[model samples]
Target: MPKIDVNKVAEILKKNELEPTLLRRVMDELRLAVQPDPGEEEKPPPIKKQFVILVSDPEQKLPKDDFVGWVLQIPEEDNVGTTPERVCRAAYDFNDTKKGSLLPVSTIGETLENVPAKHFKEYNTWVKTRTPVLVVRTDNQIPKEVVETEHF
Candidate 1:
């Protein structure tokens, strides 16, 4: 990934065309997590449900983090079974980019919870121990986070 820079962060926000206010909050959090000054109290990276999405598919026999994985967390839910689908979908969608990326939803244990248990079966978690990965196989244009969370 590019070196941590406010300029890069701003560029990302601009390129993605995100809301300035929300992007600012997320950027501030990223700074705290990725660019904490030394000797300052090291805080636990913001923990909600950060996903370590591997850019390379596991089946492709690629090394870990070989491409461009994104580390993100699921937002809090107001009710049970209401995990932050935005972050989940974001990470899951990223993981689904390649059949070999993570478990392709066709291979994960059926009893596992939190992981994508919808249509398709070959998918599973990249890590043997990971659960709730939210992987998907859809190739259609990605939907907006709001739509994904609500209608997905």
Candidate 2:
């Protein structure tokens, strides 16, 4: 097969004004398509695990009748130790609720850090009855289809 000039392809994509995210997706697909299939003896790729990080005011210390919780999806591959801090920083940056603001990372560390991460399937079963206030993908590991799914 002829070699593909990736740089030229990228230049063409850029000239067409393709969005960066779309360009990334296209490149990923191209890479996948070009990869050789593994032999039967070779092990399959590892299955990526999804975790749910729930940030909420469980004690109702905030002065609000209905405080909404933040639910974020992170890949298990992320640094478990620093995930809480990342979540806190994201919450601080993107919070739009009328409920009380998120406590500083230091103050909320005990609450967020201690909360156990739940597998996506397990969390999905548990959260069936409840509606999420805000749900976001904190990592790029999750596929676009999963992120865009109605249930997600």
Candidate 3:
């Protein structure tokens, strides 16, 4: 088989009036096409799970600057019911041990609600209608304020 000369091909393309930008783009595409497929061993990073807890203050007891929401990082394999129970227990223990006024885990459990899976707009709407919401989500789904603000 005759060896194809890259310089000769470029010269022919130039002589035929092909634009330099178009040639470059075509070359880039061909180069991409020739790349080896990613190996199975080179797996993508695992998605981290998070819990978004939106606590509402119906009695307006908390300070104005305090956030009502919290984003808690959890293990990717944690049980759905267990993590929230653990959170509630921690909140209860903190209140009981430190002489705080936070609600009991049983009470919080009663108010536990699920956010809609329809994403931001639906979540916003659901939040507007409820108090003390709990939802399991991936890291990407957490709201910016929940992670940045003081929600304790």
User: Stretches of candidate 3 above 4 Å error?
Assistant: 1-70, 101-152
Q: Write the per-residue lDDT of candidate 3 for residues 7-88, one digit (tens) a residue.
A: 5666777788888899877667656665668763676889975445544555655555533443433455655456455545
Query: What is the TM-score of candidate 2?
Result: 0.23
Q: What TM-score against the true fold does each predicted structure earn?
A: 0.22, 0.23, 0.22
Candidate 2 wrongly placed segments (more than 4 Å): 40-152
Q: Please, what's the RMSD in Å of model 1?
A: 22.8
Q: What is the lDDT of residue 17 in candidate 3?
A: 87
By the lDDT metric, which is better: model 1 or model 2?
2
Error of 2 at 137 (Å): 78
Q: What lDDT does each candidate get? A: 0.46, 0.49, 0.48
State in Å the error of residue 59, model 3.
Answer: 35
Clashes of each: 16, 0, 0
* Candidate 3 whole-model C-alpha lDDT, 0 to 1: 0.48
lDDT over C-alpha atoms for residue 58 of model 1: 34
